[model samples]
Target: MIILYDISCTRHNTAWSPSTWKTRYVLNYKGLSYRTEWVEFADIEALSIKHGFAPSGKRADGSPRYTLPAIYDESTGAKIADSSLIADYLEATYLDTPSLYPHNTRALQAAYEAAVLAHLDAIHQFTAPYLMTKKYFTPKTEEYYRKFREPAFGGKRLEDLLPFGAERVKQWERLKNDIGKIAAWYDKNDRKGSFLLGETPSWADFVAASFLVWLRVIWGEESEEWKDLETWHNGRWKKLFAAVKKYEAMA
Candidate 1:
């Protein structure tokens, strides 16, 4: 069995981090047996250190930065951090299961993931404020998140990052337009499929879907923003989300 580490959220105990969602999608799609271990934002670094999990990245000061979406593979006694690395480990270890990178498309899939994330800047900016709300995070985690992220936004209060009214509307429009650009990429697909590579589901789809899932989780399905998103680009996002919805199981 595998122990997948995920960032905890206050809403329904669901896994909400987009990075972690990528791993969850891979695990579920491959039919792997795993259980989620929810960790508070404040504890991620300590947890990583305790388990000897590799740092996910580096901080601005070049200090090692630890994050969740890590995994402990009980079967192999392997502890891995970072979503992409976890996917690679799983792909290499589970030969019998379906591959996330099929037909030697690992490089292409990695590029696609980077491309998709590059276009998500507006979405990230627009959603940051909502993510800081007390409704989304526990007390301690929220405090940690705010302290850790406020500096990035020039020390502005989370709500001030994108205030409501005209500014918020402008940011939302930017997000929608950015999403349209990504949708145009799907339009170039020569065949009809919910995935990036024609009829085959791969890591590329998981990467794209994770952002959509992030949007849905942060905005709430019933929010006007999410509803608007569902109708955009001829409902392509909605369909893509539906196709991968089954793989959203947390465990």
Candidate 2:
């Protein structure tokens, strides 16, 4: 069994972090049995440090800065961090499961994963402030969320970044264009279905779906943001999301 450490809130009672969503998707896609270890934002750094987990990279001061989505494999007493690395570990360890990178396409898988992450980074510019202001967070987690995000916004308050008027429209347009470009590639690939790889879902599908799941978290599923997105590429986002929606049941 694997124990997945996830960032979660008491209100939602489910995994809330986007990065963790990738791992959850992979675990469920492989049909592996795992349990969640939910942690608040405030405790992640300390908890990770206590478990001898080092940061993905060092800060300017060379201090380790840890984040969530780390897992502890009970069967092997092995612990791992980072979503991409975790995916690699899972793939190599569980050869019997459906392959994330079918047909030895590790390089291609890496390329798709990187592109999805880059798009996610852009999406965060608009989603971050909304996440920061959500009322579902506990007091400590809410405090940590604001403080942790300050550096990303150059010490400006998170609430101050909320887009308005033309700025809001511009951000939505950029997001739509981003989705449109990716959907265009999928459209031309001629998959003939929801998945990028035709009938079978692949790592690329998980990567794309993870971003959609993240968006649903930042805004409710019924939000106008989603409504606008549902109209793009003949509802490609909706289709991509439906392909992965079954995994949510596992969570």
Candidate 3:
């Protein structure tokens, strides 16, 4: 069995973190037996270091990296960090499970993953204000989140970025423009199929779905943003969301 380190949200019913969703999706999609360990933001560095993984990456000031969405495989004594590496590791280690990466398409799959992740910063910018202010967080997690994120926001308070009233509408419009790029790409290449690559839900599907899944995690399924996304690119986002639904953890 493997242990997945997930970000904890003590006050929210939905236990999710955007970056971690990719790994969890792969684990569940492959029917791998694993249990999630809830980790707060403050503890990720120490926990990751203890698991024998390197720091996640360098800080803006060249500090050591420490982040979550890491996995410790008790079965093989392998500890992996980073979602892309984890997905590749799982596919290679579990040959009997369904393959997420197509044969000889590792490069393409990586490109697809990159394409989807390209929008991550914008999505986070659109959602972070609401996510930080209203969503679940223990006091420690909240404190750590602010400290870690403030630098990225040009030293502006997270709450200060929240748009309201007319500004909120404008924010949504801008977000839609960013999402439109993705939707347009899908529309051009989908070839009228549900999945990005025709019938199968490949890594491309998982990568694309992870974005909206993160949104759904932060905002409830019934949120206006979720509903609005459903209508994008002729319901393509909605279709992708539905395609991955079966892979989600069963209640």
Clashing pairs in 1: none
- Summarize candidate 1's per-residue lDDT along 1-251 as a digit string, tens digits: 99999988776667778899999999999999999898988999999999999998888778999998999999999999999999999999999999999999999888887888888877757677787763677789879888887887788888767656888788878888888988998889979888888777899889889888988888888998799999999999998988898899867
Judge candidate 1 at residue 67 and give its lDDT: 90
Candidate 2, run of 10 with poorest lDDT? 116-125
lDDT of 2 by residue, 111-151 (tens): 87777666643576667777667765788887887877777
User: Candidate 3 at residue 63, lDDT?
Assistant: 94
Query: In what order do the candidates fall by TM-score, top score first?
Result: 1, 2, 3
Candidate 2: misplaced stretches above 4 Å? Answer: none
Error of 1 at 113 (Å): 1.4
Clashing pairs in 2: none
Name the candidate, 1 or 2, with the larger TM-score value.
Answer: 1
Please, what are the lDDT tens digits per residue for candidate 3 over residues 104-189? 67798888777766765556666677667775777887888889888898887887877779987887777787778777777777
Off by over 4 Å in 3: 190-192
Arranged by lDDT, best first = 1, 2, 3
CA-lDDT, candidates in order:
0.87, 0.79, 0.78
Deviation from native of the Cα of residue 46 in model 2, angstroms: 1.4
